[model samples]
Target: MLRRLAPVVLSLLVMVLGVTALAARPQRSAPPHTADFVVVAGVAGLRWEDVDPRTTPTLWRMAERGSIGSLSVRSAHRPTCPVDGWLTLGAGSFAAWNGNRPAGGCPQQAVTVERPDGTGAKLPDQESVVHYNQEQLPWGAVPGSLAESVRCSVAVGPGAAVAAARPFGRVDRYAPALPEDPTQLLGSCVLSIVDLGTVAGTTRAQREAAARTADAQLARVLAARPPHSLVLVAGISDTDRSARLHVAVADGPGWERGWLTSPTTGRDGYLQLVDLAPTALAALGRPMPERLFVGRPAVAVDGRPDLADAIAKPLDAEREAANQRAVAGWFYTLLAAVLMLLAVAVLPLLRRARRHAGPHGPEPVPRRVVAVVELLLIAAALAVPAALLADAVPWWRAERPGLTFAGVTALLVAAGTAAVRFAPGYGSTLGPLGAVAALTALVVGADVVTGARLQLNGVVGYSAQAGGRYAGLGTVGLGVFLAAALLSAGWLAQQVRKGWRPAVMVAVTGLAVVIVGSPYLGADPIGAIALTAGLSVAAVISAGGWLTVSRLAWAVMAALGVTIGLAVLDLRRPVGERGSLGRFLAAFGDGTGGLTLHRFSTSNFDTLVSSPLTVLALAGALLVWFALLQPWGGLMRLFGIYPAMRAAMAGTAVAAVIGGVLGGVALDVAGAAAALVVPMAALAALRVLDHSTDRTVPTSGRPRGVGSGVAGEDGSGSDGGGTGGVGPLGDGGPGGAGGATGGRDAGRVQPGTATSDGPVG
Candidate 1:
């Protein structure tokens, strides 16, 4: 027994060592030099293509003379509102802000403010600070906006001025235009934020005209600044569908005229809004703060004109318009396919029930048809992962996302077909399902272990351009789908053998959960909780643990213990080192937990009602449940026949449901959880049907495999050979006469019988 356990124990030890080594790696050091001054110009809803030399010559010149790239300005939470974008820019972290209500009428006494560090503090009631109404103020501005600055920072215009002054600090606000020769103002402040409010107009024409005006203003500001000062002009929000991609241009000391490469994305010509603060700080000779920020500095990269043009081309009005339509069309198509598959699974049951007239069973489906269905199922299973891999394909870039999606799907289908045809035992009852589920877990788990490189560009993974999550398993991929894969794989593994097989399967499942849930690894708080609860329960059952009320209670307790323990550990880290979970706990500790809870609840409800994919997923889940309870009783019989397999399935099913519910309540979209439950339930139903049909026996007379005169001690052919008769194994009765009996008989083959050659019914 000890020898058998050695491999599993050693594998776990190696994984632990790897995680420890990752944790001990050296941190990024501070930059060697500081910029004389930093200039931040905010142009809300400005897109790269909007800056033409004809109308906006000054802005065009800036792009020509500086490093230019598309900026991802989405917030950490859902909706990715403008408020969230600006707050992320200020905080250098994924931050949240609920709009503030005036405490008192008129000038508003004691305004409430929320910060990215997950703290809420009431600002001192000063008339100068309370000058603007909530509309004039950026949606999530808190007290001490400029408090993050190490030295003097100045703000100009209503937007930038209010954001800088709201935070608890002394900020000089210039609502009026700057002086023509403002060398003193440029020299005194380390940071200067100028808000180009002309772009705030609602219409495209107005905004275009405003852009030209803002360009002239920017030129004046640039001329007034010292020569060595670093200047950044950015668009903080999306003006319209065509303007969804924000614009950023940087120039001055240590920066060259070329494309921008952000450490956050590791890609040239792309930057996130959260990267703004850290990059600014770095230019001011500050170390990249550990843990608190999610972005890195956007550095100048020369000789990448082609790459820059390719990245910028997608922002063109024509391309953006096409991509929007493609996204919507693709989603509906995928949803339709899932619905069609559900229909295919249920049609057979309905037909079987309708034809109750005779003993003639329905004609068997042809092997070719069965094979095709299996391949399609495999294709569906591989969809997300293939999408992830497709990102690396040069032809599959964002400019032609719809075509890329189709190409990836076709390639995966072909590969899955080849696997089914060439791989040994893949056509067996449990083979395809088990292989797909196991492979899915392995790919996703490996990606998490290796820093999610594949997942970073995964069509189904987190979007770098969206600014929600940069690394780790996303809400949909790891949070929902991966959890299901682990459970399904673990359950299928149990059906193959007993003893150490189940133990090893359970151990691997547990390890995958740990890797995906680790703060230093997967970095997903809600995903960690969902996977831990679901996989832990499934693992326990796979290892031969019962699901009695008491046992289930303990499993739930254990899952909760693990979740709370991890959260507490994260909370113990310094504020700068904490992830989303840590920040959430800090908010809870600061008496602002209710706000966070409300945000999640509202988002979940909205997603459930509004998302077409989520509605279809819910429908699919209901169909699976209906099929399981049908009078044919395939699911019920399969469970009774295989005790250990039954335990694993039941535990996993329960966990999936629970995890789905929790995930919906906590994540940005409820669809992620639904994605997990639907596929798992559907596959389990398919497996049951595949095995059950081959093992059904006649209700009267001698069974097919039993010898004609074989009799029990009762002097009858094995308990009268009726529906209530003992099975061929002489152990089970009635409903258990199918594959369950065959399985038992296979182990005790009698001589001079066909039991060893084929299934005994």
Candidate 2:
């Protein structure tokens, strides 16, 4: 009982302590000076020979108002060093110990070194840093760096103790203690810090002063600033074109002091400067978990998020570049799939539609010619102002601005002109001119009044915003133009079916401008209106082209059926703002924009309708060619001249019967069988009946009047001397049942002749 009670008491005590800590924590707030945040990163200068303050603002900005310093690291005594600046910033470590790079190549022989106090030290040369393991500096303890957690001595070895007590280091002492918790370090670890000046030429006093400044600045900011939201600019630059980085806190106005330095070698100075980025971002409310030597930020920061309330940035430049290269293969594959389907469905139709359009076939009007004409019309209309009204006064221009709507509006006006010109008898120029003038007035008025209206609304609603210049009047005018064009074409097609071809051409012309001038639409009603108008124009073109040859009623019924089906399919697709069918329809009603329905499944009927008018034209082609069987003995009968035709027909019938039985029966299959067999059988039966009748008639069945000295008793002709084979009318002339005579007037009848009301002989 006491054991259970003890556990309960301990848990309660822990919970209360946590509650107290939570309540006692200070409220977090960003310092005032960080209101206007800016980030300045320093990379190795590409033009180191000409490095200047103007060229290296990141280094000088801190150096001018502040100071500069170098740092040192315990690296292999070689030359070249390469490590990311950010990694050095994180864990406050330098490449000397934290990073895994040697200065240059290993020495060729054993080398001797003099310690700071001039004591002799000797070591054999090696090819890699692995050889320096025994000689490596015991920088300090890192709390979590060890595989096994173990306590470490707070006291350094005798030689190292003297080194740690030095006032500062331009290169050596600038870095932070390694193995994070110096007291817990069981072995050596990499250290990180600011760069003091180089030890090669700097005095002890100068390096010591730099170190004190660095330490004081760090302490001041860390104490006063909130735990979050800070930036530190601590680094070194020299009169020469060389530079180094250091550590300093950036909080509020109070701690805006300068840099610190150390007396260290020039090579070590460069090694220590790589730590700035990771440390700065870490202090500024960023997570830095992973440890890297130079540029690697800590693992804690997996992704870079935008400022708390700022608009998100675009995709990372590196990621975008990689994706562009990857997407090309996929794009080409989709294109190939669409093209293959088009070829299979369209080739047959083309062959058929052209079958009976006379020689030279039905010529396809080149899309290029229409495109050129449309472009010329737009250019000419736009050029009018350059010739006449460009410099006109603002008010006058607004009242009669001919150029603004000229590109799209001109084509409609021209089409209307051509319509009147081509119409029989009731043609005039006034109709088109009046239409253009009215459209211009409506557009100009809307453009001028929108600002005033918006101002009035702003007074009342506080947030009323006038649309952009081309939005109000321009879009409304465009909508009206497109609607009128559709209505006019519809009417013309009704009047004369052939006239519908021109309407199709005109709408297709408008489509070119929409595709080419998409950028001009802007970001408001104007763009939306343009999109709607472009699509509606395309629909009209499709509808008009279909109407060219098909009966109007058939075309209308098909269009209506297709429109409803498309609306349903669109509703089924996953929808958000752009793809939502409900919103698309609403937008259509409001005359703003609309959505196009793409084809889903394949059905012959669906293909014939949803496909271009080109397909219907092809179907007509089928009628022109294969349909010859209707006029000239149904093709099977022609083939019937060969007895094999009968066998083919019988096979078809058997297949139809089997299919019907196995498929649970379909009326269509039985009807199909009848269509295949009945006509050929009827024609065959007619020929057989005519042939049998001819055999029954006789050639000498006619009488010779019974006298007058001839072969017969009448001596005109003899029955035994008469010709015998059948005559043209099957030997069954009007004179007698067994008659077969070629003469028309002497008891003979003509063959294959039709009487007044019917076929007769």
Model 1, CA-based lDDT: 0.53
Candidate 1 minimal-lDDT segment of 10 residues: 710-719
lDDT of 1 at 24: 32
TM-score on alpha carbons, each prediction: 0.71, 0.18
* Local lDDT at 687 for model 2: 28
In candidate 2 the C-alpha lDDT for residue 638 amounts to 20
Give the Cα error of residue 272 in candidate 1, in Å.
Answer: 4.4
Off by over 4 Å in 2: 1-475, 487-761
Clashing pairs in 1: 143-167, 143-168, 144-167, 144-168, 145-167, 292-576, 388-458
TM-score of 2: 0.18
Cα lDDT tens digits for candidate 1, 540-562: 45544356687667668756766
lDDT of 1 at 731: 29
C-alpha lDDT of all candidate models, in order? 0.53, 0.26
